[model samples]
Target: MPSILGGDIDPSSWSIIQVDLSQLNIQFLILCGVAGIDLAVEVMPDWSELPYDLLVLVSRCFNLIEDFLNFGIACKSWHSVATKHNFNSELPRIPWLMLAEEEEGNSFRKIFSLSNGMILNKRIPKASRKRCMESMGWLFTVGEDDGETSLLHPFSGVQIELPHQYTTVDYYDH
Candidate 1:
């Protein structure tokens, strides 16, 4: 609605419309508010003046663009400013592997970015996961061949096998 943020609203009905705030939409709305700078540009139709006081008021309370997004849901005034912020910044990084006490019980199957700690993937590539554990720069025997073992990557089709025991450990040099 055109009367989203600052519309000289007399009734609180305008405020009630901010019930379902999607995060992406809210961010866009904040960015828009920043772009619509003249309060005169708002009130005068083809010449609404940018509400500097309102923008300042909103910006001060909205420490982050995300905060302005949340405010946009409250009323039309906030919606303008909320939609004006930028979305150039990066989000948090996700985890790479998630393990649990049981194979199918409460699990922690997610990889967050090592840079930002945002949740990334929720799977472990059996072949490469061992490599992550081996990131310490040491090769160790993982599973002994009591039965058939399949080494595989979860996201890719790469695989390997260690079928029989070797007589000498010098077969392959690290």
Candidate 2:
């Protein structure tokens, strides 16, 4: 009699088993029961090894930007899927409210997601002491002292300079 795992067991009694990956835990229990093995054994799947197509499919299921970004941080392969252009465009866009800065000089800003009630703390030093408004998906920021204006993309930290506020207006004397 050969042992499966150093235990006195007959291999002939065991039959081939098919498992569904989605229901892995339940099917694993059934396999253990059929094989007369201990139920205490634990099995953990390597999520990073998931197929690229499957990972992409899972990435699309995220409606919130915060959740979508966290999915990319899971592993390198998942990061690849998240960085793809317009990978999440199919998902619904939820409005995110940018809260006031915690302190005058602090670089961190709190953003609240209306869709999921999640708050994200983002460090945007460029936005410090600037009046910000959302136009489309970018932040239109105006400098407090100089009255300069620029567009800032909060997530990507990309900034685009626009003509200064003075250039857009002409002073008229009556």
- Specify the highest-TM-score model's number: 2
Q: Candidate 1: misplaced stretches above 4 Å?
A: 1-108, 124-132, 135-141, 144-151, 163-174
Scanning candidate 1 in windows of ten residues, the lowest lDDT window is 132-141
Residues 33-63, model 1: lDDT tens digits: 8897443454444212348565645455543
Candidate 2 per-residue lDDT over residues 16-110, each given as its tens digit:
23234447878778898999998575779888889988987888888776788888988799898896562577666879999987788789999
Q: Candidate 2: RMSD over Cα atoms?
A: 11.0
Query: lDDT of each prediction vs. the true structure?
Result: 0.44, 0.82
lDDT of 1 at 16: 56
TM-score of each: 0.24, 0.60
Q: Which stretches of candidate 2 lie over 4 Å from their true place?
A: 1-51, 73-77, 169-174
TM-score of 2: 0.60
User: How many residue pairs in model 2 have overlapping backbones?
Assistant: 0
Clashing pairs in 2: none
RMSD of each candidate relative to the true structure: 20.1, 11.0
